[model samples]
Target: MDKLTIALPKGRLFDPVVEILREAGVVNRELDDDSRKLILEDEQLEIDFLLSKAVDVHTYVEHGVADLGVVGKDVLLEAGASVYEVLDLELGSCRLVVAIPEEAGITSLEELPSTGRVATKYVNVAQEFFDQQGIQTEIVKLNGSIEMAPLVGLSDMIVDISSTGRTLRENNLIEIAEIARSSARLITNRVSYKTQHQRIKNIIDDVKAVISKQ
Candidate 1:
């Protein structure tokens, strides 16, 4: 079999996938060395590993540059890119929510003013959510640290992902509305899934087996 190229999301999802591969007998035990580059190769299994941002993993796999990818549901929906979401890895769990200052006294989505300001990394998703709620608001796009926006009065509220709510709490914010739920997902290119069906199926099945027993 030819080498399989796998795109791994660099941050939170990296270690989990790497551990899975190690258990499945595909990754080298010494792959996590700090001095070594993040990308690694396993000659015995003909596997090539590349580290990429969570948002870019889907694009890399969708473009066929990688045979498989691990990405978060938040990023997947935000991109709206074409790809096969094969399995839910059930890792890096979080929820997409609308948060605001505690003193704002917001109790429900309907209670928000018709014309308000909203900040988020997920601009499209936030707009769609507000549209569905029949609320009109300004959408502000922030590249990083969205929580800080509401703190500094840049925006009235923010649509962002939260896992433990620690960041929001520290920033003196509270979640007023939950837009959606998200988790880490295993994805692949459509063409690659078709061309390398058996190999891909084997990997998928391996993951499913592990998930089923958990």
Candidate 2:
């Protein structure tokens, strides 16, 4: 029997996923420490674990490199890859928001420029949001330090995710609008789901059952 290869995200989201998997009696080892190897094996169940970046987990599953993946909804929205977003894990819950400097005196999205500059890592999602609003803003794609854009005058506003809003507050920024509320999700390739229907469904059912209880 071929072992099911599962790609697990390697950051904050991993803890909850591991906990849930343990509850399901699928995960038996620690996934908590850093400086350790990525892959792990649950010998009894013939499960292979591949630890990867949160953003790239979906790609692994989508490409059938791994049968399944645990990723954040932010990644799902941003990537928009052709994969089955099976379950909302409801862990690592947060919201993606558009924010501006508090001192900038921009209280609402409506008051912003028609073609103002915006910065974010989620360029596609950001563009789609502006397109929906019928607004035209230049998107400045940044890999990191998105909040600094408005502060240093690199951009007028930004599109980013927030959990407690503490980062926004500390940066003297306020959320003008929320793009979407996100949580961790279980996703799989369309082909994998079709080919491994019973196995995939069982895992999905087990994970969802655990989530439903919380």
Best by TM-score: 2
The weakest ten consecutive residues by lDDT in model 2 span: 26-35
In candidate 2, position 42 carries an lDDT of: 75
What lDDT tens digits, residue by residue, belong to model 1 across residues 40-95? 77787888887787889999999998999889999988989799999998888999
Best by lDDT: 2
Worst 10 residues of 1 by lDDT: 27-36
Candidate 2 segments exceeding 4 Å error: 30-35
lDDT agreement with native, every candidate: 0.86, 0.88
Q: Count of backbone clashes for each model?
A: 0, 0
What is the overall TM-score of model 2 with all chains considered together? 0.95
What is the number of residue pairs that collide in model 1?
0
In candidate 1, residue 142 scores what lDDT?
Answer: 98
